[model samples]
Target: MSIQAKSERALCEITRSIRTRLQDVYGPASADSLFHAVERLIQRKRRTLSVSAGPRFSEKDALLITYGDTFLSPDRSPLSTLHTFLQEEAGSLFSFLHLLPFYPWTSDDGFAVTDFRQVNPSLGTWQDIQALGKEWKLVFDGVVNHVSSDSLYMKAYQHGDPDAEDFFIALPPETDTRSVLRTRTLPLLHEYQTTQGPKWLWTTFGPDQIDLNFKNPKVFLEIIDVLLFYVEQGCRMIRLDAIPYLWKELGTSCAHLPQTHQLIKLFRDILDWVSPDILLLAEINAPWPDNVAYLGDGGDEAQLIYNFTLSPLILHALVCEDASNLTQWASRLPPLPAGTTLLNITASHDGIGIRPTEGVLPEEARRCLTELAVRHQGAVSGKKNSYGTVCSYELNVSYFDALNDPAVQEPQEVQVRRFMLAQLITFAFRGMPGVYIQSLIGSRNNLAGVRKTGRARTINRRQFDLTEIQQELGTPGHLRQSVLSEYRRLLSLRRKEKAFHPDAPQAVLDLSPSVFALKRGGLPGGEEILALHNVTNRTVRVDLSRYLSGERYQDRLTGVSYARTDLCTMDLTPYQCAWLKKETLISA
Candidate 1:
């Protein structure tokens, strides 16, 4: 088929898929209007690369996940300052910079977006984002699940405007919403005193944030336009925040709804048709089952789903000094498709969620991890059930602090080692690894931030002064400097091997309870990379004969080679992690 003909056919298929979804959520008339809006927007959006498919991400494609305001001063624009810092601190280390929610927000640390089209004034202008994009691959946040109650769209709903009447979810006082999943303990029905007097609006996340009604086709088109605007502005990947809750139905869990999955698939189809390079990464932080649902039959939905189970589970493994559960869970993960991979991250803007640890950690083990964080001066946020029982949801603390419990009073060097191990294992996981600002610089919990904001999540979202960070990172033997050096070394070693590609084959090796090992390779012409970690204080012996067929291997982290003696068993010191490359692959 001719190129133009193929393009037309793709457009028709996309339109058809979107129209069907629109009709399912709304009715025929709204579906037609929504399709027209999308068609016009797609036709007008030019400049996007018309590739057949996006190239698979590499181990070199490590992402630095941080807010645009992460590094700044009172005088300097945060985004511009961030660009400067990356050039010095993390430039070549991570290929992509994922700025979490740069839009103007009313609450939830920018997750409750007040305006999708405008850049937050404090975060600098679109020009700043473009500047960062020029220097590194940019990943923008798509906070489409809900909008801030202070937004203009909510104002229109208050005024009962025709086009915006159904933009938000609102039900009568007598309505039953008990089955809806609540991320917080706050009342689900937020009492809003608007121009329409008193309205009980659905607030899935919080009172300041209002759930958007995808039942309104106009809302879908509005969000679609915002996503396209991001792509036009040079975003290679757009992360959909809290996406599983996009569609709400009464007397149901209001999560992972069929309509929500349909909307995601619709988005992937339309966006890939427009620009195959722009990846749709779904931020569904549920357990493996619900989280895996976003992958959509292994192909059509999100190109990447955040491996939410990794961070907390890895922490649990290290805390308990047992990789048995982690190894068992990881072994069960099925192979990913040719181009898609999970987004493996150790930490982010929010706290370490326990929901993802449900299947991996036992009930008692789960409680212990949360208590361990609290024992180390961390806080726990809970969600209330119908019977008024509060269950722990997320542990609010820095990843470094979470791993190094003050109750045991681990030494500074030991704390740094444990923290770095957690971050390094993410690289060995079967996905694209990401580094968060707090975890990257080894920042401690900021109780001042939590007290000032009155939100537990702020404990780990502390903004650093670029000057102070530079000074501390340069200091020899300091915790920050130690963590930074080790993290950079991990990234440098990871990038040199093709076997570390996001889609490369991964086998979870059951070496011992005190250790976790991952093997990457086995593909034709692929280099075998072996990762070993000792999560305990005492030395543990691991036999290399079970993992490798070679007689000798080289450690990439340290330039050293050892000959296999007595079937090649090696002992690792406390909290030691080694990146081993096959002699054949390294010398070749």
Candidate 2:
């Protein structure tokens, strides 16, 4: 079926399933309550499916930038840099920008919600975000996955206020809940004590980030109100953080439970009925097949799901010096639901996590990938450790590690060639790519925060210095320049090529393990473009002569052209990418 038809069918299926599920959960007599919760979502999904077929980048509600604990002011604001940033990177391609949770919280990089209604004073005022929202696309987070232990609501729960306690999921005393539902961090929960003895808290991330119990209907109602409030403030998209772990069940991995799907569908339904324009993006980090579940066989559950598989796979291909990982990962990629899209990106606020595809990657390959990372960082642990002391001036260091690595050479240029190529593949893939704030400026982990606090991620989260970027503009061909320049090139290419648009169909082409290829844009009279990427360090001769007969090839990035029979053995340099287009086709 076509993308539109598929989307429509998916909407119908989701609406039907939601209605049935609600009835089952609340009984037929509770139809009003069910309708009250889901009617909007059903209506919104239908409306979203009926949009005009064109480049969605033109109509995107927002362009998300990573806004950590502090929103860097232009002189100080990394986001205000958008005024110039939009001209360079976005260039009217997107209207919305998602500022990942800049609110005060304890763990999970601010996923632990301490305050729902207010923006963290450390970042800026609600007024600052509102003003920024006015000029550009505005998207604030609805980190409803869990609340912080220090949250006001949690405090109320601890003080025995029944009404406030109702907002959270506080465990019963003397109960051990750790084994079934695991927490990301240990020490915080390792020694737990409440009014009840040795009671376990539901921590999908850390003890500080206590997972809220969605089972409690009250939790649903309150969060809904919170979502509507943000929507009312002109926010276009609300990113549901750590969505899969929202609902927990026993004897199963608490993440991505059936109820989690139901909860998202319900949220979508409500939004549809109330505000059809608002988009709900799910941060469900799972493997390809499993991640598709969040799309609800169409566009019902979430309008956008994070393409975690693509980013990691691209990184894997780059780091491992083999495009096989990219091809293998792409082969397993599931289609997106109609009307909905995937939030694709290589780097974000958080460290890379590669556990989702364990089922598909060979044990040795996984071990090798792990070893490569450790070897780069000079870390001994095999645990995908992000905290390493590898001080190679050639390697890119996260902000946290940059400070800790005393060996960092001054004028350290972040080794960004492979990383940029990795991100290029990510943006060109079948999804809406999300470029993190740090990636734009090639910001490395801040070692200053690490030296001061001894925490790497937090240090990496330090506000950036745009002035320094402009002043020390010392090196012309440095990694920072390469990153900024390549991003512009790739994003520019994506805009010119219709295949990179949200509506375009993506097909993985047959190629060697060292080469990754995909075809996009078959618009009539508009030339079809084929993308080939070489992930190997050594040049690989690709026999694409078989597929190029009677065709002309043009490079999308540099407008370089070649005849179909010009060559049989195309030599690709290490970490190089090429876009081949027909000379007969119109160039954007």
Candidate 3:
């Protein structure tokens, strides 16, 4: 076939697939119109937007996740201050910057978006965001599942505007929504006074946030336009927040519905046609199987999915001084396709979620985790399950505090080592690593902030003034400076090794219960790195010859060499990590 003919055929197939998904959600009668409207939007976007096919994902790619206002300055906007901090302190350590919901929001920090198209004036303007994009790829939050109740669309709905009549989901008070999954303890339906009457609206998150009605084709088109706008504004990636609850069905779980998957496939198709470089990241905080479902066959849905189970599993291993569960879980992970990979993150804007550890960790283990949080002056959040029981949902503590108890009068060096070991394990995994801003600086739990805000998540979301942070980082032997220095060194080393590629083969080795060991890269003569992490508070010896082949191996972290009898066994100190490479590969 001619090249033009092949292109036409591909376009036809995409249109057909989109139309089929539309028909599945809406009726067949409305499918044609919706398809035409979507096609027009895509074409217009292609004509107006100049999306550069930027560099693809690679082993060197790492994301720095933070809020736009995490760094404050008296001289400029928070966004600009963040840019300055990155340029001066972070340098080229991170390739992507995930700005968590910088839009105007009524509540929930920035999740309850009041305006979709504009940035929060308190942070900065579009130019400021674009400036940051020039230095590092930007990841914007697609808070499309719901909007603030005070948003214009909700206001229009309340005023009975025809254009916004079907923008939100509202039903009778006694609607049969018991099957709907709940992520929070708040009521699923909240009574709202609308122009029609006092109706109960679905609020998956809370009262201030109202769910959008995807049953209406207009709502779908509106979100599509907003996503395209994000790409046009220089967002290389979009994090779909609360995506599992996008499409609702009365008698079903209303989570991860068939329609939700179809809609995500449609989104992937549209993005593939218009801006092929832009990636979609699904933020599903569910069990392992359900979380991996968002990566639908590895190519048709999200390009990246959060490895929500990793954080909790790492915590469990380190706290219990055993790596049995962590090794077993890593060995069982299904192989990912070429274009999709997991985003390994140790911490984020929210707390350490327990929902992802459903089958991986036992109930008693989870109880111990929550108990540890309370002992460390942290808190826990709960959610309501289908059984009408309130269960612990997540542990609200900083990653540093979770690993090192502040009450224990240990040396700062010991605490830093233990904390960095947890982070190093995430970096050595077979996926791209995402570093939270607070983790880079070894921040502790902010119980005062939690008390003031009356929100458990506030324990880790403390903002820092730019000048104060700079001073602290400049001081010698400071905890923040020590942590940041070690983090930078490890990240730099990771970028130089090809074995850390997201698609590289990983073999989880069970050498000892106190050590978490994994080998990256193919077997035989292929380039590889043997990563060993000690998850205990005492010295442990591991037999390297049991799993490794070559006699001589060199430690990348320290320029120490092991050969002959040394290769048979090696000792790792408390919270020590070693990245071993074959001596021949190092010489080459």
Name the best candidate (by TM-score). 3
Candidate 1: how many backbone clashes?
0
Residue range with the least summed lDDT across 10 consecutive positions in model 3: 48-57
For 21-101, candidate 1 gives per-residue lDDT tens digits of 778766776778777777787887755544555465876788889989888876789998998888888769888889898
What is each predicted model's overall lDDT from 0 to 1?
0.84, 0.62, 0.90
Point out the worst 10-residue segment of candidate 1 by lDDT. Answer: 47-56
Q: Model 2: per-residue lDDT, tens digit, 264-287?
A: 877777666455566788775555
Backbone collision count in every prediction?
0, 29, 0
Q: Candidate 3 regions off by >4 Å?
A: 1-10, 51-55, 523-526
Q: What TM-score does prediction 2 earn? A: 0.82
* Prediction 3 global C-alpha lDDT: 0.90
lDDT of 3 by residue, 1-588 (tens): 996798779778877888888898888999999988998998888876764456567779999999899899999999999999999889999999999999999999999999899999999999999999999989999998999999988989999999997788888888877777888988899988887888789999999999999888889999999999999899999999999999988888889998999988888888877877889999999999999989897467999999999999999999899988899999999888668899999899999999999999889998999999888888889988774678888999999999888899999998899889999999999889999999987789988888899988999999999999999988989999999999999999889887888878999998998999999987345589989999999999989877667878888988798884785788899999999988888755
Q: What TM-score does structure 1 among the candidates reach?
A: 0.95
